[model samples]
Target: MASLKERITRLQSSALFRGMTRESLEPLAKILNEESHKAGTVLMDMNAPGDKVYIIEKGRVRVSRVTSYGEETTLQELTAGDIVGELAPLDGHMRSAKVTVTEDAVMFAVSGEEFEQLLKSNHDVSYNLLRELGDRLRRANDNIISRLEEQRVNIEGRMLRLHKLTEASKSINSTLDLDKLLTRILEAATSSLDADRGTVYLVDDIKKELWSKVLQGSNMAEIRLPIGKGIAGVVAETGETINIPDVYQDKRFNRDFDKKTGYRTRSMLCMPMKNKDGKIIGVFQLLNRTDGAFTKDDEEFIDALSAHASVAVENARVAQEMVQNERLSAIGRMASTIIHDIKNPMSTLRVYAQVMKRKSGNEEAGKLADEMIHQVDRFVNMTQEILDFTKGVSSLNIVDLEFGEIMNSVLDFIQQDLEKHNVKLLRETQFKGMVKMDQDKMVRVFYNIASNARDAMPNGGSLTVRTNEAKGYVNIEFVDSGTGMPDEVKKRIFEPFMTYGKKHGTGLGMAIVKKVVDDHKGRIEIDSEMGKGTTIRILLPAA
Candidate 1:
């Protein structure tokens, strides 16, 4: 489009070719071919051999190269009066980067060999080219320094997160209480992630549910959901991380809890917490990030925190279990000593009471003697219950006796205790069949159940002791009209130390009852409801 003089004028204005004489630029312009390219055209490709050098006469071109991650990164941009492919020709190697036309452009292309010769023959042009290359090198150096500074800041931030995590893990790991440990983990995780609130759900494998004790102000509320129900549940089931910036937009978000608690959840990040074995044990759900949506860095930090939390959780659970086992062992040792020392004296007291009843024919004194013997037997039964539970003592003095005789004895034992508590005992003995049982232990079983019923009926209620034989078993039911158990307590009723609303004894009454029944190859079933009453049915093999 321009004349020869105009083309030479343009060449002289270029920074790399500036200060060149007309004679020096004449031959360079004469050999030049003007090429027009559309946007997005590749003028030079990375790693391609140097064939030509182009002087941009119009529009823009971008110099970019692929990074190690296979991402294309723009190095620099060249506009009109700038040149591309000059470095390849100067260095006598392949192009270092891909150059693409960002805007429709016209360029003056000269063969690489000719461009190299022009640089050598023109002294002033060569000096200007060196100056241009030196400016580019300085820019590259600045870019490197800027990147290094950014990386340094990132590394420092990561180090700080790691330090916080270490302290948090230490605090959580030292506690044997699973509840307190989970609470600390949630607190530390929320602080580390800069979230307003958080919850840690533990997987209940048997129930196929995810449950957590979420702290609300000074109280902790138990929350449970099926493995695939909610955000945390999904993370628990899938073992994947979920980051939702706008929770309201997600259909899975339930606003009911937020509405009830008067809390608004804007963003959420949930991730699976896995044990050391890489098995997902739970999920950490963080809500309403204080800053904004959770970033990649937050995700990475939480991923690490989950690892520490999982290990701590596992340790706390194991420690709690060991503590229970050790406590039971200690009780077993104490019971063994008591049985050795007390059994002989208790037998002598029972024999003396029998003699008193035979010698003193007074009706009231005889009744008093009978009570003394019963009281001695009760003390021995109490000690034996502990010994049986802790020592796994299953030896039973099996005898075939009328089931009614056992029920009548249990009724007489509990009637006195029940009368003192204003609880009425109604007896309905229908099963006359013989049962293979240990009479003393079976009496303890019936007495324990009746005692628990009496305690439940603190405000004067009726207990019906009924028996019936069916399906090769004799069913003895202690139906009480008293304050019953909640599902939570009922589920763990047989576990040692589990108790509800009782203040008098070690919470091992039901546990011993279960152990005694289990030894007789019998099973016990319980039906209870809050505010209603409880029915404990013990079924023994009918002889």
Candidate 2:
């Protein structure tokens, strides 16, 4: 125990006691006892009676709790000029924690009874403690509120970005043009994420290559990279998203693109473009975030853009395929017409050689006579058809003939052929008027249609040729109980070499009839239904 004067000297040196005026602190200072503690000495055992309050005068004291593992974690370390055990003095409760002197320490201690008596008398001291407690509580509350507000802002920002991305994906899926769709993707991606640069690469899986389709930024056109060689390639190969805060330090970053474009890379975000099947179609790479490096929000938005791009690219390919089909159909028709012309002349030459061989006898006159007859026979059979085709009805002598007379000539030529096949012909010739037209072309038209009618009724069916006059025109109709056509076939029937019954045609007969009719300023209509029958109606002007 020390004298009251010595105790006062120690207390006066302490910050806790110094907060009071010299006269006011004098009483509490004299009541305090100076106690010396050694290292490893327990100052207070947990849950023990709280008798005294302590003010550390020298050395240090540690306040700690025993953890579940029986290890001690120091909550606070009190050094000289520090106050402890003050909270315990406010209430006569068992100590909630144990206190130990970590090093040799000298502290001034006062009893809880003395603390209570001093608290009742010193209103100014009590008021100061109350204010300190209130300040700590208010500060704790403010800290909690600030953290919660920050969390809420983060959540809201993510939701807004998600909604915009969903809307953009929907818009991109609605178009089929590759260029337009890719342009929309760039605009939507950059705007949605508030990114500074964006580019979409279309993957050529077959070639194992990635090609840029749309590139946009402040100076985005400057950057270019090859597949399997850069950040874009990593994302494309692994089908993962990559975000690098600093491209300069990353070993995976290739500087060739920077060297070529003269654009330095600071940060990069890249994602793989995948189709519905999770097949990597391409890559989308963004460079140098304007504000800060791209975060998780940017990786998510790039994924959305890539998904929509895959569908758009597929649709464009389908449109291109359809166009190609139409072009091929046209070419087939032209080839068939050329073949028909060449074959006719060859047939005439073969016939002439056969005829000449049959007429040949031994040597001179007999052989000459035989050769002349054979050559004439061959010439008649071969050149006859070729001559008729090349020198069409336009060069034939014109004649004023009744429409029924032309129909009867064509009907007569096919009558025997039809009877042999057990086919029926129903002729309803109503036109009795005359028309000035090429007689040969008119014969060719009727002959070709009648012949086609015979071929169509392979199992022997009815054929009807009906004639009528309507609106200053003569109309002739051919109805055959033959396999009809679908809409697609019907539209293309007039096109040369477009044939349905493959085993029975060179596909040129109807085409020839169509051309002749067209040349004569005639209109022809065909109506047919699959498995039902076909009706061919030819209309010509009446003179």
Candidate 3:
């Protein structure tokens, strides 16, 4: 919008035209190209051929170069009266750096031929342009040096972290203690990546959850979450690594733990650990990296570490299995010898109890003998259970029996135990029907349940025993008012060698109980809650 006279005055103000009078500037200003640019516009790209020189009459533009890592380092900023792309045209080479508009600006441009002729004719204009180019060259050199030094430091830091990971991998494979192994894996991760806190969750397929146990001070905490429920859980389920620069920005992130613990979480990285077969076995979660958010480099480092950790975990498991197998071998031999030695005495007692029952018929003595015979048989069966368990063998003699007959014997036998533990037994045995089952094995099922309930209620509680018939099935349910199981134990309650809160517990009671029910074509269902109680219901086919 400027008039011809105004444009002449503006040209007169430029240092490049400092020595020119209005007569000399007027003809030049009329031919010079005028251009305008918005902020962030790239006026000159690095190494691109330049055909004209630009003089900024307004606004500012940054000159920068991209580093090897794709980071841009600013070399200089030019505002009004500064010239750019002049050196490249004068020297007959490509532009050395990129020029970007930092703000909206109008510029005056001169073709390379006109610029050269003007510089040649005017000494002051040439001298001023030389001074500005010298200053830019010096600053550009300094910026390049600084950027190179930064890249060197970054490379060295990465090398150090990789070295730490390599050494940790060596120690990890040799560690056989699973708790110690878990500790080592997490320690290496947090320290190597500069993370604030972390956890390693092993997947429990039977429970369909990602679970971990941590010892905080003197207490051990067991945490469990469903697969695909949270970030880490989803990583485990999908076998992918999830890196969130800002946890608060991610809707999938749960901030409740941070709120409760008063920990400010800024970032998170979760990786899935897989076994040799490519099956995901565990998940690793790292929270709040000390260096700010986790980066792509961090993810790469963690991915390598997770692979090493997976092998270490699997190796520890294999080593444990070897030890356990050896232990069971020893237990099996001792049990076999003991069972052989006790068989003769057990048979003799059985014969005597039967004879006493037959001889004392029609008297009170006969009833006591009958009870004694049943007690002897039960003791024999109990001993056989241990031997059979060690040998991994089981046999059942199925028969038709009534619920009333079973409950009557169970109540009579468990009454002494219930009184000893101060656990009162409430019965609802109104329903009666024939259930197809093994008499001895069925008795073992009820006995194991009573024993487990007694152990659960150390201080004194009530155990309710009820029986019913529905849909051609007889149900025997035992509900105990005792301390319930945690999720970890409740999930695998039927698995062998799983026990809780017992000093001399064999951990085989529930395993045997479930086996007995399974063998008789019946099923056992259990429901337990912490600080409340447990309910165990057994269903058997009715005759």
Q: All candidates' lDDT scores? A: 0.87, 0.72, 0.85
For model 3, how does the per-residue alpha-carbon lDDT over 79-168 read when each residue is reduced to its tens digit?
Answer: 888888888878899988899999999888889888888888777678878877787779779877887999899999889988998988
Candidate 1: global Cα-lDDT? 0.87
The residue pairs that clash in candidate 1, if any, are none
Residue range 294-367, candidate 1, lDDT tens digits: 98888888888888889888988888789888888888888889989988999999999999999999999999
lDDT score, residue 107, model 2? 84
Question: Which runs in model 2 stand beyond 4 Å of their true positions?
Answer: 1-129, 148-156, 214-227, 304-543
By summed lDDT, which 10 consecutive residues of candidate 3 come out lowest? 324-333
- Among these predictions, the greatest lDDT belongs to 1
Give the CA lDDT, 0 to 100, for residue 23 in model 1. Answer: 77
Clashes of each: 0, 6, 0
- Ranking of models by lDDT: 1, 3, 2
Best by TM-score: 3
* Tens-digit lDDT string for candidate 2 (76-102): 667887667767667768887789999
Predict model 3's lDDT versus the native: 0.85
Query: On a 0 to 100 scale, what is the lDDT of residue 537 in model 1?
Result: 91
lDDT of model 2, residue 382: 31
